[model samples]
Target: MPYQVLARKWRPQTLQDMVGQEPIRRILSNALEQHRIHHAYLFTGTRGVGKTTLARILAKCLNCETGITATPCGTCSTCQAIDAGKFLDLFEIDAASRTKVEDTRELLENVPYPPVQGRYKIYLIDEVHMLSNHSFNALLKTLEEPPQHVKFLLATTEPKRLPITILSRCLQFHLKPIPLELISDHLHYICKQEQVTADKTALNYLSKAANGSLRDAMSLLDQAIAYGQGSIKSDDIHAMLGTIAQQNLFPLMKALAAQDSNQVFHAIHLLAEHTPDFSNVLEELISLFHQIAVSQVITYQQKTDQQITELAALFKPEDVQLYYQIALLGRRDLAYTPSPQQGFEMTMLRMLALQPKQMVVQVETPTLTVAESPSWQEILPKLDLSGMAYALAANCTLEKIEDHKVILQLSANHQPMLNTKLKDRLRESLSNYFKQAMQLDIIITAAELYTPAKKQEQEQVERLTDATKAATQHPKIKQLIEMYDATIEVSLL
Candidate 1:
């Protein structure tokens, strides 16, 4: 016998043999058992997700000599013929080629006739959306009201092109893409059955490269087997798919998490030897960061990798969020740069540069005399406040500080940040700062005030304005602008 491809040889011969389409299988099986099969059925989904395969199994169930059943006896002549694609009653039409109205009309011409061998004359149209509008018009009448012994099974990757008139006459079921874990498990089973020595890592790479298509995964598996000389290895799969190995991804992530710039560059330098696709590298980082974030919130049944668990502990949740966002935006702009490696390096450096700097509030020593009191700005750094509590205190000015009570005035604009929990935290921090218990009162008003935060902002603006003025007055800048007929836009560091 000639060599048969794995996809066709392992094609599902029965509904029970199908994978990753539980709902469709259950519905079709119930329909067969209850004799509630629709005259016209439409299956919609992406390619290689078992739309036509399930349709063939349904045909076998309908025409088996034993009876109409969810489980057709494969030993029967009728079931065997349908499986072999030689059943006289089964008409497998490729709508892509025969899209003319005349072809459709000719096919429907026989719809009124009875079955020659099987119980029903089944018309299975693959890629039915390719049929012309006129062809659809010609077949609408027969499709809607076919004879009792005829069944129409239509499959298409794109269902939107089909007219609503035809769609309404058929029962449509949309198949979902197979999940990565399920695909990997299935591939592992297939390798075992074929007596092939395959590593788990190899199967994982194949499943991910398949992108939710079993047929594509099977075809890639066949190529991997031939390329590896009847073996499946992670290195061979990575070389075949132009994907970076998962182990290599961990070093990059670890360097980023540690904020070690030297290690990050070193990792990239080592990665250059493989000529890896930087875009895929960024994607892998994004995916790993996502997994780490999920691990922090939920406990998975399968234990996460030791490296991932360690790296997850090294960064804060907010830091992970910041890195993930920057990585995604970097990927979007990567193509515009001169080279992908340069873009990827810049992205990683940006993540480290913008790493959320932890706030370290340092209080100056009290240098004032007993009569000279400290201002709210001077007292803010003394208080052990952080996060929202620190923000609330920074935005407010002290109106009065008494023996047992204190009054703070918050600007009307910042009133939205004030809440009961934040107010309590502010009061606690103030009591600790003063080394005494205190009651607190807050009042909101639109009044001119010099909050510590406002003072800091004013100081920053003045410094920037001074720098820009100095740059604008530089003789070199003036000479360059005149010589090149160019404009100088002074930007402050």
Candidate 2:
């Protein structure tokens, strides 16, 4: 009669009711039907992915009054008692608390005794990894060879902590995290059954916020129901979860795709009122870019808004990849910045600034005279390059320039930067610099000539060497060694 949370209330009583774990359910079901019961079984997965729930369902199957069966007759007293958590033979231990070797020994002392009320004495230990090394040692012998009437169901989120000796004895069933769509559908079904009016999009946010855990999704759903006063909508869910509105992100994406600084700032200002977590905002932006990238390759029914489709069309595939990589790096470096907002703004600025430079579209070639020919190092800094194009140029040494073809040697290690798109951009930049359409041929040979990057490194090393020599010959250094016989640990300034 007491109030039960949706997670507990909707707990799968049989394997058939479980969602998004078909493989695990099928294996357990086959084991039950074939009576291929193992003395010890281990269920390993993250929290709320039905590790304990599956263990309970397996216990019911073992003790069901009709017989040991895959599909337990839920009407029977044994199943009913187990469901109510009052079954005598089913001992559910929270190993986190009872982790001492003595507790393990005491618990195993009863393993020899026959089941009091059921066919099998089920020892369901939750968080089995929390047991001490000595306790695991204590459990090893009995766990390997328990009594005929005994069964061990070990569940742990951190299975790696469990000793290999104990792990080897058990039939390990590693449950996977439920898929996003499945969790969303499950939440929608629960909302309908509970008479809770909810938008599909609202359920989607909850499902994603759950991060592939059904119990987590259900908990968030309960909070959302109360937050929305029983009617769940996307806007309210976003507000409740402190999540960036997906719609607000579209304008920023549009601005980024168009390389419009003003619109990017305006869009970010609109979100400023919400005081959004900029890291999460970047994450949402990254997600949108990822979706757009996926759309380029695989053709699927568009569940996205017209804005997303239009934005996807606006940006090329290479741009999406570049923006995604920049956003990820920005998010990674965000914590070290002065503030989250500044870090986020700089990231957006970077995307816009790099866009035009990285664009591979044809443009007017710059005028150049043969009399003004300069070294590759000087030529590199003079060229309008940034991002991968700039990086590719900096790492290359000019081999030869004849008529319309320019040959360069890049280090073999940096060959990953030698893609068709980068090559095309480099060729275009060279054509503009040379005032003629040029073909850039790159060879993956060691750069013997002074590259821009190599020249810069050489300059830095020379400056450091000069500074160290200057300091070593200083008057103060001579006085210190002569006066006190002090040996100084000198380093470059």
Candidate 3:
């Protein structure tokens, strides 16, 4: 016997053996146990997510010699025949090749007849959405009122293309993409069973590359086993996939965070030697920035490397956001560039050049005159703060300034936004702005106090009022109003 690929060899024979679709599995199992089987069932999802496989399992459950069951006995001839794709009653049709109305009519002609060897004649149509409009119309009547002896199992990647009439008659189950961790774990289990040596990191790389498809992961695993000569390794997987190691991306991120032009180019030069897919490199960078941003804003629970945590602390949240957006655009525009490497290099350079420069505050403290004492609103813009730190500062009113301390009064409503990190950032910004080290002391107060945000809101309202008044007074506007009998929309103005 020829050796079968991992995907086929590991094909789930029972519903319980299927992985990563617990909700669908539970629903199908209950329906089977209750014997509340639908005449026509539609399974819709992306490729390799087990739409067709689930359909086959359902067929076996209905036709098994032991009788209809949620757990069909694999040894029974009916179950064995269905699993081997030799069952006479299970008509597995690839609708992509036979999409004409004639083909649909020909298939439905047998629907009225009783099963030759099984309990029910099952019609499993894969990629059913590929059927033409006329074909769907031709199948609509039969699909809506199929014989008691017939069952229709339809699977498609795109269900929206299916007519409402056809969709309405069938019980649709949307299979979700398998999660990465599930795929990784399944691959690890398979490797152990196959007696193949494999690294966890290699499986993880394959999992990510599979993009939620277990079949794709298994196929990639088969290729990886051959590529590594039976021992799966991370470096071999990366090379096979045209991607760089995760650690290789760290140096580039570090260089970007430091905003060192020479280091950035040097990192890129070293990365290019690996002949990686530049688009994938950009995607990795974007993912890293996103993780960093999440780490900065929240108590990120996802397991991250120590370097990522350090980089998260080293880079500001706003900078991470900016870099993420730039990397996104860079990836999109990569194809139009002269070369992938050039496009990637330009994207990295753009990130480095556009990063906000650190303000060089003089260390010496200067005495300020009474006239030179600036208001909080005046100082807010110059602080160059962003994210929650900016919001915290904007919502607080300056209470007083002591020798080494700055007191702020935060409205009780906005007190929830206050945190130790924001307070430290605010303090550092103030110290920089005043050219002296200062500590922040925030007091939550219910007393009404003017803040920069409120001041700015008032100023905007005044400007809008002035603009509306000016627009209403314009001669052209008066003529148009008189002719059209229209009132001025102050908000629009």
Q: State which candidate has the highest lDDT.
A: 3
Which candidate model has the greater lDDT, 2 or 3?
3
Q: Estimate every model's Cα lDDT from 0 to 1.
A: 0.86, 0.86, 0.88
Error of 3 at 178 (Å): 0.3
Q: Candidate 1 lDDT, tens digit per residue, 346-419?
A: 99998878776642222223232223224887889988999988988889999998888989999999999999
TM-scores of the models, in the given order?
A: 0.71, 0.71, 0.73
Q: Model 3, poorest ten-residue lDDT window?
A: 361-370
Which pairs, if any, clash in model 2? none
Candidate 3 RMSD to the correct structure = 16.3
Residues 341-396, candidate 2: write the lDDT tens digits: 99999999988876624222222222322232246877887788899999989989
Ordered by lDDT, highest first, the candidates read 3, 1, 2
Position 344, candidate 1: lDDT: 92
Instruction: Please rank every candidate by TM-score, starting with the best.
Output: 3, 2, 1
Per-residue error for 6 in candidate 3, Å, reads 1.1
Distance from true location, Cα of 92 in model 1, Å: 1.3
> Candidate 3: misplaced stretches above 4 Å?
300-304, 357-493
Residue 229 alpha-carbon offset, candidate 1, angstroms:
0.8
Candidate 3 contains a number of clashing pairs equal to 0
